[model samples]
Target: MKLLTTNTLMVLLILISGYGYIASCTHDDIVPPAQANPTPVITRGENVHLPNATGVADGDTTKWKLDKAHSSVLWSTAYVGAAGLLTGRFNQFGMHDVTNAKMLKYPTPSRGQVLPDTSWAFYENDPSKIYFNGYVQMNTSNTGEPGRDSGCILGTGYYNTVKIIPGYQNLEINNLAKIKTTKVEFDPLSNDYIVTFDFIWQGSLASPLTQSIVGRLKYIPKAAVKDAVTGNVLYSVFGLQLNFQFDCRDFGVTSTSVADVIDIECNMNFNNK
Candidate 1:
């Protein structure tokens, strides 16, 4: 009877130990509830607005000079009945002389002239206050191909027959092109300047042809830079990017392979004089 009681107690102890071990294993296998990620915070920089032209001091004569090294004029034309575009640029071009009395004039409200309140960003609201005259040497036209470039200057072969005049030995003199801005209007919706300019080009025609073109001008205003050590203002720079399209046929190019429509982009940079 003593041996039987001892064996029964030992069996009860083993069963209780086995149950405790199984409960611990089951508790370790349980996973915690999933957690959601936190929301991210975004910060934006301050917005810088363009300066108002009317705010300039009265009689302020600030002249801007063209930075030729940073300026470029690019043109492209699609081939007639072809799938490629021919891109080229004039190697020589420059901004015409601008005077303070002509280019940068103050507003005259007493003369019944009113300036737009919101449209006075770059220049005075009056289109007459801003003037831009530029010239291009058409003889400097470069298309990367020596043969095609020569044809463009001499106006022969693939290009239309637009040779220089008989007496003019210099091709550059006869092939000169000029552009002068006539009007400038700001479009608030598109943030672009509607510019009307006259494009003057001399082809094989007896006289230079004039075509009035309307182009979209994008103005990029830059802040003035200062010397790091002296803290003195150095210079201020701005940019004007003009884009337009015109029919080349108007300039007397009658080539069948050359497309009539030509796209032009002029990225011009200017610095305060």
Candidate 2:
């Protein structure tokens, strides 16, 4: 046995500490460790930075150019009478420019108050006053199963035993304009603009069906940043969320395994691009 000097013991301790740190940092399966739980730590502080101004400046007829990259549409249908649900999303779509949108104050949140008002109203005479225009290509849909996606949506072999033609190829949900909100409401705290609109769907089934539907839009505001040089701040950045339901039978989607009615939800975020 040899006695270790003080210098040698210090070197050994440093090597052990370094090795332990390296081992702790290395991942087992190339996955990082869970992050610390997020919680508000600041109660009051003078170092806090606040925006110079913040409000939805767009008036009753604010024309917004949608940010397509950040926008998306998702849909889900019952697999068998609510026993299970199959959800999918549309990869390609666009929002037609808005002409004149009605403006309403956001309802003040209170204790035991319901958040979303479900009462909806529609235009009787003219349906073009305010509407949403968008389309979904049947081929671009995804339901987590490649075989089912290609066969059911694209009419590949999986849909039918003999490989029949796809029933619905492209669905154009145009003329969603007749939908009139009973009242326009904005959430001041979250800057969420609430409106209900009627959506029209033009199906490409064997019979070429057409139907009108209603939905709700929760237009929430995204964060804004100020220019470093000019100090001009960016504002009015918003994202519109739509959730609605429609019958698949109307569009000729008569699959016993799938449900008759499908629920659609979309989110469209807009910026000053």
Instruction: Score candidate 2 by lDDT.
Output: 0.46
Task: Please provide, for model 1 over 118-187, each residue's C-alpha lDDT reduced to its tens digit, 9 standing for 90 to 100.
Answer: 2212453444455566665565567888776765422233222234343322224245666778788865
lDDT of 1: 0.61
RMSD of 1: 12.8
lDDT of 2 by residue, 1-273 (tens): 145687788899999999988887785447767899675342211211111111112332233445455667787876685676777776545443222241111232332111111122212122223234444444456677876676553233321212223432222222111232333443334333344443433343433343545455554534465787887874446555777777766654566767767788877665442
Candidate 1 stretches greater than 4 Å from native: 1-62, 97-128, 152-173, 225-234
TM-scores of the models, in the order given: 0.58, 0.47
- Model 1: which residue pairs collide? none
RMSD for all candidates, in order, please: 12.8, 16.0
